[model samples]
Target: MKLSLLLFFTCFLYLQILFSQDVKKQVEVGIIEHLDEFVPSDIQLMNEDGKMVNLKDQIDKPTALIFVYFRCPGICTPLMDGVADVIQKLDMKLAEDYQVITIGFDPREKIDLAIKKKKNYQSLITNQNTDDGWRFFTSDSANIARVTEALGFKYIKAGTDFTHAATVIVLSPNGKITRYLNGTYFLPFEFKLALIEASKGHSGPTMNKILQFCYSYDPVGKAYVLNVTRLSGTLILSLGLIVFLVLIIRKPRKRNYPKN
Candidate 1:
């Protein structure tokens, strides 16, 4: 009876190990294909000039994307304002290397409204020709849906409010998501760092990136962060070590038990 029980438990443990191995394999596969899966699609979006433009064709260089509704009274307005403040503080030469794209989530908004918003932001920038670097646009529902889907942006319209991730996504010149800044407001320093990292130090300030690397997330500060995948992996590894230690400590006791 004892041997039968042991065999049953052994088989259960073996199955558990196999299942875990399968899960780990799946996770590795996911990580391996993450970049390929996330490459932005060549969805057509309308330009400020009311021309139908393909997103991939519009990229003269790397770009940052902000998702918002033009009429958003709560988060979107201040979010854009805060981002504009950061852009204002950046040196013009460094800022010229990248473009800022504001995509309105509201389908009713026309290209004229988008052009107005672009002009508003342009007025805020201290440097001339910031318009060449910064841009804004609104697209029809279909194109907006396509671009947001590509970027993994989920939103629900709640009467007068938009319930969505208040985030900014940084994309490579080839339109791959490099880093995402969560929350409506972001620190200029962290934005600068992410830009530098993306540009490989040929664009944004290197010294600022180094100085700001060690700072952790502050919810009130609305700072950018490393993604949750890193945190979850650390947690899983810690739990694995604890389980291994517990098994090692229990093995000797089980071996020493009297044969009954």
Candidate 2:
């Protein structure tokens, strides 16, 4: 009887772990298409300078919008670094052609923290004039919810931290969602195409479809891991072939093209 009880208890624990994994998979899959949706213009946030401003005012040109909290211990730093690297590699001017905006999703995060984060990333950029082009913002929970919901940016708070997907939203000049780029590492050519599409007020294809099958964040590891789920293997190979064909057909453009 003692041995049987111990075996039952072990089985119960395994089942519980499997259930939790299923729940997490559902949550990750919840983040999906918000293409062509216009962001909430009335939502107000405090900029790095601690000045109250409407969210729409800062998006007069193509903007790469990122939602992250300063205290995030997981994917936030990598996400910001990826964007900074893309900005440095791009041939286009920052403020003149496009802009980058980061908003802290945690209401507890203060403008001082935003300013400090801004300074850290700004130092990485080689273009001095791009200083004003990149901005950081913090806002109250009410305003933050309004914008996050509009963009379909789902995040769940766990104690003092939040678990959210690592992705970037490309917005048009007038604050319309144009494209979604999944994961931290972005190719410069794909990023340039996104910016060009956004500048012309055109929405691009969702990049998350292929990414979902290829990677999933491991909360315990605090990093992305290979997604070896049942159906992912076949989908991964199919997407790989499609990407290869697309790349072969697309010719590389000279980096000297005039900025919009």
Candidate 3:
């Protein structure tokens, strides 16, 4: 009976491991990083005012490009809110040093919806006069596809909704991809560094890279939690340091003999 119970427990553990691996694979498939890739400027999109604008014309300064549908039932709102929070905390002047562009990825979404959504986020910003610094756009599927492809963003439709990763793409003044900030919550310092790098027309690593190595995003909780693998690594490192210190302390000091 005990042997049977042990076998059952082992099978359950194996199944849990397989399930975890599957979930990781699903999350990873929805992400693609196009670091240093140049976004095509010729694609056309309708601005909030319903004016036709070329993608290239709007990116005169370092830009933060966000792709989300205004009507998304999940992830989109929190992602935009996170962006607004970061923008408000940033010391940089909008439009002068950098700007933000939010493009609705759902082709069926219209200019009116885009306008309304823009207004919602704009109201969150303290500087109302800097409205020009943040622009919202809606366009046909063809144009949307071009931009998403260029940025290496991939999304899959699930019923009437979409499954996608929360990301912010930082673009250089010339529209080259500089960095990607993953997850809804962003660190202001890392964002500021991204802007500085983008302004220089170069891609640089985000400050969160090392932190991300130690944590994994918890989609259900909408936060990053400690990753077991990295936590184990950290524990091993600590143990090694402790062992080294013990060995050094135990080593006998050189005997002081009566030297002539």
Candidate 4:
């Protein structure tokens, strides 16, 4: 009787634990948002050529940062294809305004593999005018962590497989994340809107980047705005100029009285 009772209790505990897990999963699903605000400024990673690169450095121009493993036969290839298609459909003027940077998630993948994948993607996107916009890179674990951690992108390695999200981040010319495209079904309108938003309605970061030296792309406004520091300085300088002008204009005029 004692043995039978112990077995029954064990089964009951298992059921309770299962139910608790179900509840936790339900909560997680309910709480999931579009993205969890992952933006990294100082994060740096090594390129396939053994050169160091950072997101901040890319802020000089608008770059589409995509994360995927070169070996992914399922979602990654199609995801990349879809992005290529989206870029191809864009008008030439719009296409030239931005750049695409693809990073392989698997550090084990070598530069040759990355180069091959890049070549395949290039074949899919035939816009000769925008050829320069696309790039592929491989990096080590340290750089990957710096980037993934800052962007709130997470992944799990189970045996030989990886579980990760299908997402791409559009950063302003200044390297700040302006928008995130999630899932396989990416719409051209959304991508265009995000690109314009990132470009800040300037049509692209033609002039603002040099003067401001910051990563900021506002998709809605469609123009690059000054970074916080530059914006502040501009405001202060304007105020000072106004004060100086008032002093000059209001300076007491010398009395024009006849010589005594």
Candidate 5:
């Protein structure tokens, strides 16, 4: 029984590893988040009018910030659509209660593309001044780096495209990060609450990221791959636990004794 316990514990320790080598190989380039941290002051972007503007100067109300390129072949459009849908459904008035700012992370993109995208998404919502609230932009790579790094939005360029997480960053009126909404779709209730909290300068961590914990982002495939190592490790550990229990619970066999 002692030997069995020792073996089980050894297996448990081995199973817990789940192979760090896989994590080391996979680049962790998603939203790391800097809750309550103020966005850096100097990050500049070229607005739809082709004029340079400081990002900090634009935040008079709660803002939802997004990072994307105009030419993305995946995820970006759906994310923008989700934001537009939420905006259309929200009871709070747009441009008066809150605003959305989207930045094209690729420095090579120009403000003209941003303007076209603004119009494209603006068409999705009605009965509101979409032009004023849903703004798009482009910036040089340096400014892009500064803003993304400050907010913990990480991405990698891959053959003219990029690999990034789909998320919207909520910021307070004073430019402090208040929340992050992950994934392509936004719930109107949650979106409204995030904006409401931002208005009050409240910082909160939103973790609708169970899939991220269970999966690994595959840069080459541009999809989330299951972390088999973790699953396999857990399965092995479960088997070991069962074996340990059996060893502990089963009665020891008694040898027949001759009449003394």
Candidate 6:
């Protein structure tokens, strides 16, 4: 009877966990990272000049791909601002060593708004050539879905606004996703590192990292924060060694008996 009860409880707990995961999957509204995956060559978007341009064709250099609607009233502005600030800060020349492509995910958005938005941000930059380096686009729902899914950018349309996360997806010259720089703010060191990796077509995964994971750059604090988990683990190992050494040193030594 006890064995049967135990099995029943185990089955019930498993079902509850599965249900929770399924619900979470349904409302998952942020990036579902597809590391090292190549962006689809066929996905196309309309450029600021109202020309249909293939995404792959536009990515001839290390690219920072940003997705936003021109009319978005939330995180989009800060996101674009973050990109602009980083561009101004970094020594790397824009559109030469790397390029930025901002795609409008709202199907209803058109070229005119895209062009206006591009000009707005371009004006914010000082002495930087915005004509070629940073470009913007508008895309239909079909192409947007294709590209977003390819890059694992998930969003849900709520009323007139959309729910999404602020992030920059760094891609190599050949359109391979190399790294995801999260949040509206960014650090120059990590940003440069990500671009360097993207330039070489390397994916910085979470578990099996290709670039870095231990020493992450903190934008607010303006410092590189070491991983606490890794640090604690190291301390535990060192503590064990110290304890063993103390035991060995304190241990009583055998005394020599002279012809007792």
Per-model CA lDDT versus the true structure = 0.62, 0.81, 0.79, 0.61, 0.84, 0.79
28-129 per-residue lDDT for model 5 (tens digits): 567877999998999898987889999999989999999988898787888888988888899988899999999999999899888888888777788667
Model 6 ranges with Cα > 4 A deviation: 1-27, 206-260
lDDT of 2 by residue, 174-238 (tens): 99999999878889899989999999999977746445545666677767677677346455555
**Model 1 over residues 129-192: C-alpha lDDT tens digits?**
5656767777778877777776666665666655554567776676666676655566878887
What does each candidate score in C-alpha RMSD?
9.2, 17.3, 9.6, 23.2, 3.5, 9.8
TM-score winner between 1 and 2, please give it.
2
Model 6: per-residue Cα lDDT over 1-260, one tens digit each: 46545755665576556544543553345566788899998998898778898999999899998999888877789899999999899888898988888999999999899999988888889757788999998889999999999998877786787767667999999999998887779888888989999999888964312112333333344333566764565466557656755765687888989995
**Least lDDT summed over 10 consecutive residues: which range in candidate 3?**
22-31
Clashes of each: 0, 0, 0, 11, 0, 0
RMSD of 5: 3.5
Which scores higher on TM-score, 1 or 5?
Answer: 5
- Say which candidate scores most in lDDT: 5
Off by over 4 Å in 4: 1-41, 48-50, 92-95, 129-131, 201-260
> 185-220 in candidate 3: lDDT tens per residue?
888898899999999988865534344345665555
TM-score of every prediction relative to native? 0.62, 0.76, 0.71, 0.60, 0.83, 0.72
Q: On residues 1-260, what C-alpha lDDT tens digit does candidate 4 reach at each position?
A: 46545755665576556544543433311112223243566666555566767756655565677888888745677778877888878663433677888887787887788878877877766654434567677778877866766654566564565556556677777666666676555677777777777776222222211332332333344233446864565466557656755665676867888898
**lDDT score for residue 53 of model 6:** 88
Q: Answer with 4 or 5, whichever has the higher lDDT.
A: 5
Model 6 TM-score, all chains together: 0.72
**Which residue runs of candidate 2 sit more than 4 Å off their true CA positions?**
1-30, 232-260
lDDT of 2 at 206: 74
